[model samples]
Target: MTLYPRPDVALICGVDEVGRGPLIGAVVTAAVILDPTQPIAGLTDSKKLSEKRRVELAEQIKQQALCWALGRAEPHEIDQLNILHATMLAMRRAVAALRIRPEWVLVDGNRTTDFGIPASAVVKGDLLVPEISAASILAKVARDSEMQALHLAHPQFGFDSHKGYPTAAHLAAIAEHGVLVQHRRSFKPVRQVLEQGGL
Candidate 1:
């Protein structure tokens, strides 16, 4: 078994983003300041966890964290600013919302615009850092919950089934039912719908 490394900083906050590739909904980011005094087990990348496990870990992180916060950039913002900048904005907002300021931030990616505090971008950091993993779990579960709620508004697209990813089912629904307001019109499928006069 390989051991994930924890940040060496005294008060480190983990940052991560979700929904960057979704064809709909907001890009959500989460920042978690873990209590080094009380470390949680089973912390790893959110992608490595089952949905049930992610939900469980999200709850555990919330309950056991020193401070945590979530932020998001809406579809319109993503379209206006581009996904990369929008994602970074979401991360910045998440860190800003934290009740306790972190001395250092460990972000799970190759790039970050700014973190307010000293920060380092860890390539595939989510899999290697407990705090980053906690952030990933929070971001994934929150975005999933949002997509599930959107499912209630547009059951025809089966948002619950695909969680806003561009699945064959979702594409078929768009082709058949036309694009809904929740769908990102700037995305490839939605753009195709418009170009093909499906809208």
Candidate 2:
């Protein structure tokens, strides 16, 4: 068996996910490899940046990164596999979708996914690693856009405002309007509502 070499040159990719806490929609992940020659400034955790800055940085990352890809696991999948496993699945998919194979992946958070490619998990890596920050921005922008689109389909949930998070507004909406097909039934809040026979 030919063993993969340790990450060097263009072989290391950064990975991150967004929408893990949302009660609806998919857990979206991104994998990005930045070109050493073209460095992006102001890279940081996606949550720290304003929506405007994240959008701008996301576009810049997409245009300048050596290669990047996104992956996601739908609510049904999250319910079936659990959030942690579904997140791993999405991360693996993102890595696999890369046009060029990476020797290793650096992922944000404390647990690493079994993506075939070797991976190391770093706490707060999204803030410290430029590539990971880029990935975070990409994932956040993609998932936020998805939430906006979802709002168009089901305005009752206020997806565009809360992004399906278990905010008071969303909970109240669910209590008033009942659950949607996109809601994660496995989540405690949604499960409680379902057990109570819905709205």
Candidate 3:
């Protein structure tokens, strides 16, 4: 695919998110404004990068980019606002937190936030845009780190292994240990499990 370059270079920001489908923990979003002249090599979608590579690239993106910021929507907030809305909220927060006000916003997915700036929503944008890819890496790494910390407190759930996503192992652990505060009760899988013998 021929990825489109930013139409305008002045303060162009790219946005992407992580952990939206997780059954536990907060959803994270990142917005990054890159230096059009100095591009970071090996920047790509977070899903395409290894954990080690993602860590390395995130550091590089942070140090090399003009500015970047991460935002999160907690489990309670996700439950209250729903995933789609919460994801947009996180995206908006990320963009707002950036040190520079962006002229154009390129988002990783179809949803556009109310940033009051001109924005474009590109499907699978993280794969196509360098700045979006950088944002994706940052958000993924940050959320993974947070989940690792959660694993220490809730060892029974094995949050580190599944990263709060709804996998068979994570579901089984939830079934055995019962719902913790981190579990999103609003999620159908969690709600179903809770109804089944109070697991």
Candidate 4:
């Protein structure tokens, strides 16, 4: 892990969210506090890594991080609160779930919610901060696993392949198979389909 300069802070937490754009499932967030002594190599943005690498790194992170927690806002919550607010809610929950309170928090985005701690939003932080990258990988792997499970239950929707994103295939599947309970009714494509009585 790349050591960041934090003058008196011993516990620094990194935060990130995944699945915000997906039409189904929850918006997942993760908080990670890395152990300075347990450095994890090859940490970077989850999107920059292959699926195999991400899965491998995710395991390492779970085993090695000082403390880590995941939080999520379900599809119903996403529809009620909107993606932005729901994402913030998830982030807050992630930090709250952490066993160790961090002296400082860094979020991987341009905006951060009130974490009730010293927190800053770093644009593309997952690329620059190892802790944020670790959170990103964990959130992604968790969400993708949810999608894979959803696929097994409803393979017609292709959740495993597209991860519930609003891809053409996913849209077509919704049109043909109707909306699943897992789909977010607030999303444009899903809303359109529902309005057209496609569900």
For 1-199, candidate 2 gives per-residue lDDT tens digits of: 1212335655789999998998999999999998878988888999999999999999999999999999999999999999999999999999999998988899999999788877888788887778788999999999999999999999878898899899999999988888899999999999999999994
Every candidate's lDDT: 0.88, 0.90, 0.89, 0.92
Candidate 4: residue 51 Cα off by (Å): 1.1
Evaluated at residue 36, the lDDT of candidate 2 is: 79
Winner by TM-score: 4
Model 2 ranges with Cα > 4 A deviation: 1-9
RMSD to the true structure for each prediction, in A, is 1.6, 4.5, 1.5, 1.5
My TM-score estimates for the predictions, one after another, are 0.94, 0.94, 0.95, 0.96
lDDT per residue (tens digit) for residues 1-199 in model 4:
4445543678889999999999999999999999889999999999999999999999999999999999999999999999999999999999999999998999998999899999888878898888899999999999999999999999888888999998999989999998888899999989998999976
Worst ten-residue run, lDDT, model 1? 1-10
> How many residue pairs clash in all the candidates, one count each?
0, 0, 0, 0
Clashing residue pairs, backbone N/CA/C < 3 A, model 1: none
The lDDT leader among the candidates is 4
Q: On residues 23-65, what C-alpha lDDT tens digit does candidate 3 reach at each position?
A: 9989999999998788888888899889999999999888889
Which runs of model 1 end up more than 4 angstroms from their true locations?
A: 1-8
